[model samples]
Target: MRDIPVLFNNKDECCGCAACYSICPQRAITMSEDEMGFEYPIIDKTKCVCCSICIKTCPVKINAL
Candidate 1:
């Protein structure tokens, strides 16, 4: 089976809107410090039910699945 990866966009593409985080009903998404010094989103798989809410809310094509 192919692994469903939790992808992250590079800092330049991230807008730090937290829309993905807000949309996740499982609260699996969290804001982290991007390398470029901006807040960006990361998935906490432990809390993620793989419902794909974060993927849908990513405005910058952050989701790879």
Candidate 2:
């Protein structure tokens, strides 16, 4: 698969939800613990297939254009 950019907004609005993490079939999204001990979603670009699953699963404004 080709390389794809996976970026997240760390605006503290993300509530450690696993929607994006669970929906990824390629196991691309990994949960990382923050200083507050909350699991945050981190995408592994190398493993990502550019399917945009995480973007679809994300409840936030992942893309507004």
Candidate 3:
């Protein structure tokens, strides 16, 4: 994919659950730390295929429904 598969409008939207990282078929997702040491998923664009699987499994998105 040309862009990262996952995008959050705010930091609170993510809980660092790693569901995306664990489920990525291509292993394109990795856990990364922010300046404040909070971990989040970072997509390797080179490896990502624009799959929305991460979005489907995200707790934040699921709970929003």
Candidate 4:
């Protein structure tokens, strides 16, 4: 499968829940702090397996009502 270059489209779309980070089996997702001090998931392309687990685990996308 083809790998995606980036995970989130907008930084604010993320809820800082760390669901993606925790769900990554390959440890490809790292929680990095933004300028505002909120942690966001940063996907490591080199370590990512293109499993798409991170996308599935994203609460922002899943919890959207």
Model 2: per-residue Cα lDDT over 1-65, one tens digit each: 54464446564547677888899999988999879788888887778888887776777645442
Roughly what TM-score does model 4 have, to 2 decimal places? 0.84
Compared with the true structure, what per-residue lDDT tens digits does model 4 show for residues 1-65? 77753557897788888988998899988999989999988888789888887887777777664
Q: Which ten residues in a row have the lowest lDDT in candidate 3?
A: 1-10
- Tens-place lDDT per residue, model 1, 1-65, is 33333545456556788888888898778788757678777877677777766666677764433
Against the unseen true structure, what C-alpha lDDT does each candidate score?
Answer: 0.70, 0.74, 0.84, 0.81
Candidate 1: where are CA atoms >4 Å away?
Answer: 1-7, 62-65
Ranking by lDDT: 3, 4, 2, 1
Q: State each model's C-alpha RMSD to the native.
A: 3.7, 2.8, 2.0, 1.8
| Candidate 4 pairs with clashing backbones | none
Off by over 4 Å in 3: 1-4
Best by TM-score: 4
Judging by lDDT against the true structure, name the best candidate: 3
Identify the superior model by lDDT, candidate 2 or candidate 4: 4
> Which has the higher lDDT value, candidate number 1 or candidate number 4?
4
Off by over 4 Å in 2: 1-7, 62-65
Q: Each model's TM-score?
A: 0.67, 0.74, 0.84, 0.84
Single out the weakest 10-residue window by summed lDDT for candidate 1: 1-10
Give the per-residue Cα lDDT of candidate 2 at 44.
79
Clashing pairs in 3: none
